[model samples]
Target: MKQLVFGTLPSRSTDQATVTMGDASESSQHELKGQLLELSQLVEPAEVLHAYAEDYISNTQTWSTAKDKKPRLVLRPTTIESLCRVIKYLHDTGLDYKVRSQGFGSASATDVLISLSAFDDFEFYKEEEYVILGAGGNWRGYYDRMEAAALDWSIVPARTPSIGIGGSTLCSGFSWLSSQYGCVSDPANLLDAHVITTDGRAFWAAEVDPDLMWALRGTETGFAIVTHFKFRARPFPENGKLWAGPILIPRTKVAEVAKGIMSMAEKDKQGEMSDRVAMFLYVMRKELLAFIGATQDMLVVHAYDARGEAAGREEFRWALEMEGAVDQTRGDMTMGEVGRLQEHIGELRGTAEAYWAPICLTGEDEISEDIIKKSFGWWTSMLDEPSSIANYGYLLYELFSCKDNLTGRHSSAWPRPVGYKHMLLLGAGCAPNETKEISDAAKRSIMRGPEAILGKTMKEVDIVPNCIEDYHDVERIYGSHFEKLRQVKTRVDPGDRLRGWIKPSRHESG
Candidate 1:
């Protein structure tokens, strides 16, 4: 291995291993040696094992990038048992390793420190509505199998048809239909997972306990090397549609345009079980336009297109009509018709790649103008500095509420207002390899900017949920329930293999 610098996240460390690829010179090295020796003896030596001694490594940087890492050895284990053997060797040896899902091409959008180039596995059960796919399976491939049966399913697949399904689900994740269905993760579809620990033990991460389920979404990746995932069943829309391109608006009214759309969107959120809708906005040529659509609900799109376009135009006119702007049909489109849509995702992802690479922002979906406005500003700000005209996306501020706003399929906790005036106020930015400076600055801008614009009243009026298990930063978002998640992590990964993303757990040792 070259003189690559690897830091222990949340902290930093130097790899003396760079010298002899040998154990540390003193105590740390001795312990490391013992562990490695023990681990080596347990597995087939590099010379004997057919799957051992192959070179591999995972990095968010492209191979051509200056910061990329080259591995000492790469191994390909075909069966779960072989994987287990491989993991055990690493675990006992205390080696550093990263697991990846092949199609996770986040490098184009975010500063993805890892890639699936060295990892590739895709397996799913077609008829069962349940699939045990490797982190590498592209959602399109997974969808092809599930969609055939008209499956109502959800996975945090990449924005483009080629994006991998793994990293998107576990890290820096979000969703389009999230407003209607909850975070794609809320479907309760992930049934089980196969993982490799840092110390290299192989284990199945699934529990009858709900605590374990919560942890599965939030912290599993760091604790274990996820090889494959089993998902719960979900129903897919009859067909899928894209609401098409942007509804142009002048820059001055961007804030009002956002607020007005969100006000209407909030008003529409009523019944518990309703069709899903998502709205995304972007700024190009000094105009603001939002993209609205669904990945599975193709039926209501045309009606929604007219409805949303009208609503947006009205909001824009009221918000910016005095500015006197021209309305142009940017374009009409579908996700399947990839061309620029894919490129946009690629472009958007490219922005993220340059900024928020390592810190995974898990998300949830709820229909609250407050969350919509705040989140759009928050997500978009991360990339505003990256481009001359910042491209922001993931403005999925559509409402899922129906006629019975206060009442739903299950229940209610928030005080329902007669009509919470709102519409989708937002944007999404995708780029590859976003620097820390850029991501941090964007976070501050959006985190504080929205409150000043919307005031605290809107937050009280809207409900912000996500497409994953996260409760945002509310600490109480899940409301005293996250304890269960910690408990689950402690149980399945007792040794604390989950900390590969960070340092090993304090409670456990390597």
Candidate 2:
């Protein structure tokens, strides 16, 4: 993976840690290979394989540069007992192991890698009003099963249906339903979880440890290797479909279009805009130069509603009333259909290196056109870069209502600041081999543009709802709950075997 460098900032630290090399002794490689031989005999049929250098090169390549570390030994476990035994053996042997689920980021890299591909379990507990899923399961698979049942359910729609349920849920996943239900791991939807901690102890998160359960929902990677998730599912809307789609905007009218969207969001805080409506605005490079003889960049307005088309139209009247629209794809569609659309586009951008830095805002202040226009301008600058991957990025606006999760029986790991209304996320993407200099500069501009607009330094505003970008302070990511999470981590992972790109608060001491 290409190295990521951040500008000289006071509070933030540079990330330099790479994948661990197991047993760093001079003869460590040979010793580890021998140990694997013993491991294979202990768990027959469960493969403990050693790879050639060529195998390392092939397997190390992942969705993006962020997760490019190669593991020495790849262990594929077929049963829960086998997996637990592997962990205990690694613990007893002092070997560092990392778990992989869909292979999206740096967290998958370790000395001994445990791939959960064989743990692909998915089942619907219709009588229990929940779905039990293996940690390795994908959203697309879950959707297929739900469609077969012909039942409507509430899911924090995966931005692309290909994402693993384990990784997304662990990060306090964002979803299309977030505005209505908070995050996907909003405690209410997370019925229970099965996890294996660093101490070689395995149990359900709820029955054994409540604090561990909170850590599991959001600040997840450092706590345990979650094997199963029993998520509380909700029935689909009465229409069996939700009104949703994206409205394309020509670059010239970005500011004009944004004012209306922000106005609606601000009004919604006061019960003026219907809770049924959730929308986000983004700028993508693919949409640029698509029109004939136009150097126009593209701004997209995506809205989804459960209250029907009339209410949905009224909700986005500002954008609908605009004089010119590049295109609009709006309709009543099933949840599965939405996932497929996301999957199609998501696949296109899968190989590109991506970064996310989201700054949240309060409901009390009005979102001005100046901030919107400035933000878009910052996003447009990257288009000048030579590489399409480096140039392809977006400025996102997403709204979140904390009402439901706030009133629930248990507290969620997702931060709900008083009067917090929405988020301004700056996403920067680049090709795999893009030069570090180009990618770093692009990331800096995207990360700081919003801070400059909001008249706050990066240190003042905390970035929450992270999606693979680990350059910021993790303490800021978890905020006041960092200490509580740290306490839980101390209890569950005393050996510090479980690690990820998202550093734990304890790392601050080093």
Give me the candidate number with maximum TM-score: 2
Which lDDT values do the candidates have, in the order given? 0.38, 0.64
What would the per-residue lDDT of candidate 2 be over residues 386-483, giving only the tens digit for each residue? 66644556677775433356445248665656555577877777777678886776567666765666766666665655553656666666667667
TM-score of each model, paired residue for residue = 0.56, 0.85
Candidate 1 backbone overlaps, count:
88
Give the top-scoring candidate (lDDT): 2
CA shift at 325, candidate 2, in angstroms? 1.6
- The ten-residue window of minimal lDDT in model 1 covers 294-303
Candidate 1 C-alpha lDDT tens digits along 10-80: 21112222112332357576565554344334333321122122432222323112122333233333444
Worst 10 residues of 2 by lDDT: 1-10
